[model samples]
Target: MIRTGNEYREGLKDGREIWMDGEKVTDVTTHPAFKPIVDVRARMYDMQHDPAYKERMTYRDNNKTNPVLYKLPHEQKDWADKLEAVDAVMNDIGGVVTRVGDETIGEMWSLCDGRDVLASIDDRFSDNIDRHIQAVTDNDIFHVSANTDPKGDRSLSPRDRDPDMMVHVTRETDAGIVIRGAKFETAAAYADQAFLKPTVGAWADEELSDYAVGCIVKMGAPGVKHICRSGFAGKSRAADYPLSNKFDEVEALVVFDDVLIPWEDVFFYRHTKAAQYVRSSLHRYSAFPYVLRLLYVADMMIGTALWNARQTGLDKLQAVREKIADLVCYREGINAHLTASIAAAQRSPGGLLMPHQSMLYAGRVFAVSQLQNMMHIARELCGGQICITPNADSFEADGSGEWLNKFYSLNQRWQADDRRKLLAFARDLLNSDYAGHRLTFVQFAQAPHFSHLAAVYQSFDFEGPLDFVRKSAGLSDQVKG
Candidate 1:
């Protein structure tokens, strides 16, 4: 069922333990640091009820309206519809905000595709996976992913150093199992739940390990503590840091102090193969949304650069045009990969439509690895004015206002106020502290660079190339065999 913005906001006031900047946050919906982002998420929910957006944002099943984002992909139109829904939200919000729900709900879908692997360990575990997937869609829950645990040491095992370094099953109770550890999760403080699982590690050889566990964690459950990093909002004027003030999705070190996971919530436990399968294929479907966000980022860069060039008449220069072309190539390169992936979409073992794995992963690597250089090019095109420009306050100050206006005013169209606003936006987008954090988020948020490349290597088919080379070299049939 589709929920309103106020209902989603009220859901977070469930007395969940949340801490930020060394103080407990009483209400995430009202907290200054979280309120802006929370409002953005709330607005997304409310849009589903708006007549203009209701058709695109929701679908009717059994005469009950449900969020389109939560629906499982079984066909090609399912994917296209999801893409449209996401675009509507982004356009409505006027900026990018990841982790709202759709970008993360696919992690469960990935596990659902691994039902066979899970069933091998326990048939009941496979049943749990299906039930949970249906539960999220049916309930319209806001779900996020939890994969990275704060490992104390790389060389030492959890037993040698600290058992809490990695999340493990502390004890099995009749109702469920208790867990203790911490995970670095984005939006955990405001999200309703997280699909907690193991980080990337070797687990194939072991028959059983406490570290091999996966389950659905309720964010408001007892012993779930959310210690969030200091937020960028409320730290500066909104005029100076528009994106940072409105779009920052807070990350938290979520501590699970003997939290209980009921039997129905546990998908897999004490099974190394299940853990390995999840770690390997976690991003099979989610990568589509993850990489698609970059396309908007690329457009932001292009728009900023092109506008700056137009303001100064640099668009007339051949050299300037060449750099603009470079930015376009970066933007379209991502576009091509996403488009081709959908065109060549493959059916999963679980009967769900998944983007072509090779193209999707290759797109992720290309978009993430080349982001910094693209940002640099945009920065150069924007020129040093973005950094040297004074704040909006200075432009309005009595003593300095007139002098600043005399200098900043460019032409009949470019006034001092507009110029200052543009510079401030460009600064926050490319040079501010928020800008740096966003770059790091793009790099490591999904996984490290090597992991993206590894996915590409694993998904690509090698036999076609091998066979073609063998035939070209006139090799015998015996060699082929």
Candidate 2:
């Protein structure tokens, strides 16, 4: 039942309404702007089928009625194994852009009923969770999540927004609920089945009932429309270069036009107090996945930056080595945290595996805080070489071809064109508009992350440590008079 890459590509050709720049995309898979994105996703699908990666990336499970899993496991090891597969594929591609690899997206949606983190909230969603897993094991569908709704103003609540600004449930019926408004900055929607959640938490007084309304619909369902974002890599002629080709410039705003979500699909409804818990749960499960991802990105950046430094002969300087050292620390710290989280994973009563919330949050907080430093260190170390490197087109151009090649080259071992390509990629990572957007994303996801750490600390009994301190100080455990 393992689908071929072409089968996956053909699967996406199904009718969907996506709008970009005042025009409706007739076909998502065939559109010029979207074709490359599809091609990239297809490559991920191909990876699952590739003889080398097939065993790791795809799996077969007894839970699966159909044997779609390339490598099947009935237990949590299957989940972890699949995660490893996702990490390997993502690492191989440069993690920053391939944020929603086919496997990553598929796995993201694989737990719609909150089996991952929402397991504690309600046992009812477990069936929903199993259904999704079985279908994924059967169809091998791709999915992406939309966690951020366009708040319009951070200071205001969802209800305070022009109702159309935030994705909110508008009406409730016995059959299903209708959602209005839009989700912003969604990654790779064109290639996805549906966005998972625009979160039912952070509710305003009026938006309370709307909060529990999370569900999935086919892309281009009755009211769904995709609004495209400008991309840094796809438009540039230098996109043919190594990193750019794999980079994800595919993003869109998901505007819901009174979309109907069935009751069966709704996981959490109006549990205002549990809102934070639900959001926290999603982050809990996601922490390692992203850490697994960032570690890969850091590796790519370090290697690419180092190569650029050496190619330009700037690697000889003590200061440059120091910068490289700092970058390496960033990479190492995240990996260490990733390892810690895995070692600390907890088991649920129902036999589901759950990651340690405290460690997971800590790992993400570390990643979010240090990513800027990693990028800055790379930029400062690389110096003007990153920005000044001529575009790939310039190397192939008749006008300045000879001048660029001669001037950009350093030693005979590295060609000028080769150096240009490396520097160009570094430049895109550091200086481009999309690069800034990515940084902003990291900042947002990281901000207030420490709150969860504090919550975990508060929830756990530290009386053992307190008793130790008291005993060491010879203080009495007796009550005060």
| lDDT per model vs. reference | 0.91, 0.62
Write down the TM-score of every candidate: 0.98, 0.84
**Candidate 1 segments whose C-alpha is farther than 4 A from its true place:** none
Clashing residue pairs, backbone N/CA/C < 3 A, model 2: 59-69, 59-70, 59-71, 60-69, 60-71, 60-72, 212-268, 212-269
Error of 1 at 79 (Å): 1.3
Highest lDDT scorer: 1
Worst 10 residues of 2 by lDDT: 65-74
Instruction: Compose the digit string of candidate 1's lDDT tens values, residues 334-376.
Output: 9999999999999998999999999999999999999999999
Query: What lDDT tens digits, residue by residue, belong to model 2 across residues 1-481?
Result: 5566688777666666677768887877676666666766667777776778867776545543232222233345645675677666665554454344332333333244245445555665545556555555577666566666666775776556687666667788987778887765444455445535545345444434564545656665777778887544456664434444445456688778888877666655554533554454455445556566677768867987788778777788898888888889888888777676566666633345555556666667777778887888888776776766667777878979989888877778997867776777777677776567667766664235555465366434567777887888788968222
Report the CA-based lDDT of candidate 1 relative to the real structure: 0.91
Residue 332, model 1: lDDT of 99
Model 2 residue 204 distance off true place after TM-score fit, in angstroms? 9.7
